[model samples]
Target: MGRSREKEDAESRFNSPVSISVADSSVSLLKLISILIIFVVGVVIGLVSSSHIDRYFSFRADQFNIKNIYFAADQFSSDSEKMLVNCERECALSMESFIRPLNLNHRMTDDELFWRASMVPQKEEFPFKRVPKVAFMFMTRGPLPMMPLWDRFFSGQDVDKYSIYVHALPGFELNVSNSSVFYRRQIPSQHVEWGSVSLVDGEKRLLANALLDFSNERFVLLSESCIPIYNFQTVYKYLTRSVHSFVESYDNPSRYGRGRYNRRMKPDIRLTDWRKGSQWFEIHRTLAIKIVADTKYYKLFKKYCHPSCYPDEHYIPTYLHKFYGALNANRTVTYVDWSLMGPHPATFTAVNITEGFLQSLRNNGTLCSYNTEKTSVCYLFARKFDSSALEPLLNISSQVLGF
Candidate 1:
């Protein structure tokens, strides 16, 4: 009986509820600790990821905002084709009077300014006998691969008939002085944004810089990809004899075009006074000065325009048409193929470029008429060429185009 009691007691100890309770408590504690660790790690990762994304978007938004301001200003400045006659006088006279103080003050203060520099004359008589100097204003993002071809064109018999001014990106640090063509030829430039009012500002800035020197009679704005279809001599002769400026004007009714004309342009208070055109142009020195000096229109444009509508296309054309309809040939010298509809024009490919293509583009009779006798041959420059077309153009420079 004593032996049986001892065995039963040992079995009872093994089967007790106290031992089961201890095991359950240990498992529950382990699960809770595991969940805590996972939660902590997840929180840390989420915070770090959120910070990175927020920083990236913030940078983008800042850039976007700056660009928007520029576009709005440009749209506000452009004039509408329909309103050209009514707005031209206001654009010219108002802007000139507004900027006169700034110009006169700058002239009085700075000896190195453009107007002062215009007083100095070349020791040697001007080259190209009868031809006036054509100032090729290069508005570029970087080194032009086609510079060599331009070098050849400018290097022709009468080198002094043409001058080159490079308005490169502000941060592009390269020794341009080494090249004879670009020697002492750098103009002050700011960062230019695509589809922004900054482009109009940049162009105006370029005009101001050119006008300071005064020797630049004809100002032609060319991009990095632009190649001269005719030699410097031909271009110089063409410009000097021409009576009118080459600025394109068209009736733009698109949402981002003339349709966005501000209702708030003071004094006039009419939406019909706005306009639009291509950004490229060849302006006489008189027009260049008028543009730089403009204040009333500039203030109005800067105030009411927006990014939804691009103003560069309308500003110059509208302003020119309004003030100097007789001065402008009413056509752009730069050829751009807008057959393909998009924000950008059709980029010319290597395969598409040929002797035949060149002839066709050159012969295209889109010239604008001023009087019964004179016709301005429409396109002096064509753009958006693939970088590859450079070599072919160079090879045929002499044989094909006389450049």
Candidate 2:
């Protein structure tokens, strides 16, 4: 009976739908707790990783925005620089066109020319580097026959120390090489008649042109017939060092002096104020500017001083005596022989260009003050040399003249 009852209990227990023991229940609870903990840990890790990823993408986006901004600024700056370059180029072209014209034939009137030349710097010192230069102004009727001799005289000299200006007849061009010093040195010219107001006009025109160059501190007037009696260095040193201008001015009672004075120049000019001089002159820049700026005196001479009056001979002398007498040395550096007793000076020919004759002229038995000391070296240049004398002069230029 006992065995049968135990078997029934076991069967009933098996049939009673999976009744669990205490140990089994404990194992199931532990597995459930572990699964819940693992799920919570996974959720927290996902939240933290997602936040880190978002921050990394945000930083990269900011870096890309900054690069785009810098690129745009660089493009704008490049465009601005190009525009500035174009503007500067255009301004430079405009300025160049205004300052320098294409043609050499400047057709400006004398009134305009003088007005332009008279414009001087008001300051005591010049704005630019000022190396004083001597201006040799040549007023010629036609082509220069003595250019070869002059070329030799000027060769190998410092170009900056001297300047050349030629005022030939209108429409005339000097046929010189580009390498020649006189090349392209011709200023605009007018028709100049001998012994007329036009002659004075031509001289003033040369002065006005020379005055345009601020570096020209001394001005010497010359003609095609004129020749330097000494070497260039000697002439330059003598002229530049002298305190007084070498303008041959003197008061004479003869008809050539006071007789040439016209009463029509009444209060402005008088016989007592009249004087005579050689036309060739070497004046300082101060006197040069004064000559160019003169209007009243020039007009009076133009109207009254005719052929017999000889404006070239009397006007500048009278003008200087009346105004700037102290500035002149009262003599000429250029030697002219009036011993032949004619209306004009003696015309030297080839035969006259001897070594002895030149030597006499150089030490012409006359005493004149040079830089306040009396000296026998009176003459620096001689004039009215015939074109035929050029060869003889050239022959003696090196040895006797020491040029």
Candidate 3:
């Protein structure tokens, strides 16, 4: 009877609804706790990933700022270096100009100072900022007795149109002529012998000084005896606006031409290269720079071109012909009447100052390349006029020169 009672109790416990409900409640609670744990783990992982991304961007931003600062510092350093170099150049030019004068204000030895000045134009890299000016360089042995005529010619001209430089005899007195445009135009000069290196030296000196003025686009080497055949306006137009230079370059195979070439000047100046022409030259700035910067041919001419070889006539003509014949006119604008039976041209007296004579110089029916094309008209300047003819020239300046 005790065994039968225990069995009935066990079966009742298993069948009870209250007991089954408690067991189901425990299973649900355990599932909820497991979900909460998974949610908490997901939040921790997302927070760590976001923080890594933020740190990466912040590091990139700092690196970019550092590179920008370096670039700015480099640019500043480069600019400072350029400024220092420019300042040094200016200071050098100033000191050179002060110690050795290429100008007319002070006395100096010829050639070297002028040579240094000429190098500035060639060696320097400068920007062009102004229109061209003409340097009217007068190479005189003594006083310019015809100053009155030149003064009248230069007068009323635009001051910016031209400049003047005169190479006179050393220790020569200016006299009472200190009031004219040619007054303070005297540069330090040395004795110049016709047909010699010294003459070439003098010409180079004038060119060197003129080249200093960047605005001086044209260089006209005139003499104390030279007189302008046209007015200032006409001359200025011819030189400044013209394409070709007025340097008389000719191939003279006569006694003075091929005969003047020395074998020592073989490579630099061959016999076939020997040329002859007038000493006077109206050169463009391009040619002027070349002239001042010459070294090889110049030295050869100085050493070998002597005695019968007139360096003044041969040096420039040959050099231009050999290298720059295309740009040169083989004729001259300065008329010299070589028809006279002598080494010198016909000297004009006051009697020869007729208006007809002046007109003949303007157009002698000879054609030459003007501006760039050929034209029938001719001369613009004349030389070998006696100083006595100044009075008569002044008398006819207004009517004839078209002033």
Candidate 4:
């Protein structure tokens, strides 16, 4: 019976569901809780890591942006300051040129002495000096092929009333002496480059050189290609009788004309007050002095103006407008055509040189204004003519144009 009972117990134990111990159940529960804890910690660590990565990249991007802005601002400031320094140096050099002659009169050579003596202000003399000579200041790059033509024009009956001053390129080795018209009459030569501030400097230097020994009452700036369309008598009479200086004032909205503005010339002056005009001009002795004597306006212009920012187009116009608006005639004696788009003026070819064209150029409207008794005569000189046009211009000098 005992053996039977043991077999039945074994069968029951094997067939029936087994009962787990409390200790084992507790250990399994503890292991499950520990696993859940580990999973939660890993998830938290992943989120934190992702957030840190995003913040680090954002900070780097912001830093890069700031550096770019700072670099741009610094570059602009540096350029502006550099321009200012250059302008100041130029002005000082001009003053030195003017004053050196007066201080070192005996030490200077004939050319230098002449320049110095010319700058010295002459005391107002008795009854207005005999029609003061007009100095035709010519700025040229090479030999003026139109020399023969100019000779004919200048050799007119009243040619004695005027003198010629040629500012040729220093490096040019031309035989100007071959022509009596350009004989030993060359002024001190200097280097000049187109589309550069040196152009402005060259002009000033020419004026200074001419002023040195010549007692010119009137100064007319002209280019190599320029030709007189009127008789010498008419031009001289017109200039001597003029009451105000002649300089053209026009609106130039291009990068070169507009870029000359600066914050340094503010409050008292504004960009809107800025103006532009032809590089050529005709002025009285008094106006010439005013230009040379200027310090404040010149300093401001040179600093803020450049090649991209053509100070030449702005400097003279702005200074004259600001200081001597009343004295200015508000018209340029030099004629230019900006109708065709290019870096240079419209060139008149041989084909374009006709009697009609010459007549049209000489035609002055029959209108009267301040100091004008009748019609307003147009420009004294026209430019950008090809060297070949010299023959056509000379052919019609006396018959139609009266030069």
Number of the top candidate by lDDT?
Answer: 2
Residue 40 Cα positional deviation in candidate 3, in Å, after optimal superposition: 80
- Better structure of 3 and 4 per lDDT: 3
Ranking by TM-score: 2, 3, 4, 1
Residue range 1-403, candidate 3, lDDT tens digits: 8999899998898779778898999999999999999999989999999999999999998999988866666566565455444545665657444433334553345556556665543345445345678889988888887778989998888877788888877788566465677756666677888868989998998888777666778988888889998999888888877788888887777776777778888887887788888987898988998888888888898999885788999899999999998888777878898997688889898999989988888877788878667876667788988999999999998998886
Model 2 root-mean-square deviation:
16.5
Q: What tens-digit string does per-residue lDDT give for candidate 2 at 1-403?
A: 9999999999998966655566678899999999999999999999999999999999999999988866665566565455444545675556333323222345579998888777767788765566788999999988898888888889999887788989999888898998888887888999999889999999999988877777788999999999988998998898888899989889888777788788999898887888899999999999988888899999999998888788998878889999999999999888888988998899999988899998998986889898889999888888889999999999988999987
What candidate 2 gets wrong by more than 4 Å, as runs, is: 1-105
Candidate 2, which ten residues in sequence have the lowest lDDT sum? 95-104
Segments of candidate 1 deviating more than 4 angstroms: 1-131, 176-179, 266-269, 365-367, 374-376
TM per model? 0.65, 0.74, 0.72, 0.66
Output the worst ten-in-a-row residue range by lDDT, candidate 1.
Answer: 101-110
Q: How well is each residue in 1-403 modelled by candidate 4, as lDDT tens digits?
A: 9999999999888766544466678899999999999999999999999999999999999999988766665666565455454545565567443422221112344345334434544565533334476878889998887787778877735544777777788766447554565665566666777756667666666566556533467889888888888878788888878887887655567655555567678865677767888888888877776676555676676666656656666777777887787887777777777779787879898898889898777774544343645555857788877899999888888887786
Each prediction's total of clashing residue pairs, residues at least 3 apart in sequence or on different chains, is 17, 0, 0, 2
Candidate 1 lDDT by residue in tens digits, 1-403: 9999999998889788888999999999999999999999999999999999999999999999988866765566444332443444455566333322112112122224434433434465643233455778888887776777777887745644666677778777446556567665666667887666777777876676666543467899988888788776677777877887888876667775657777677564244556677888998877877777666676566666656556577678777776787898777778888989888888876777678888767777554564445454656678877788888887777866787
Give the Cα error of residue 8 in candidate 4, in Å. 99
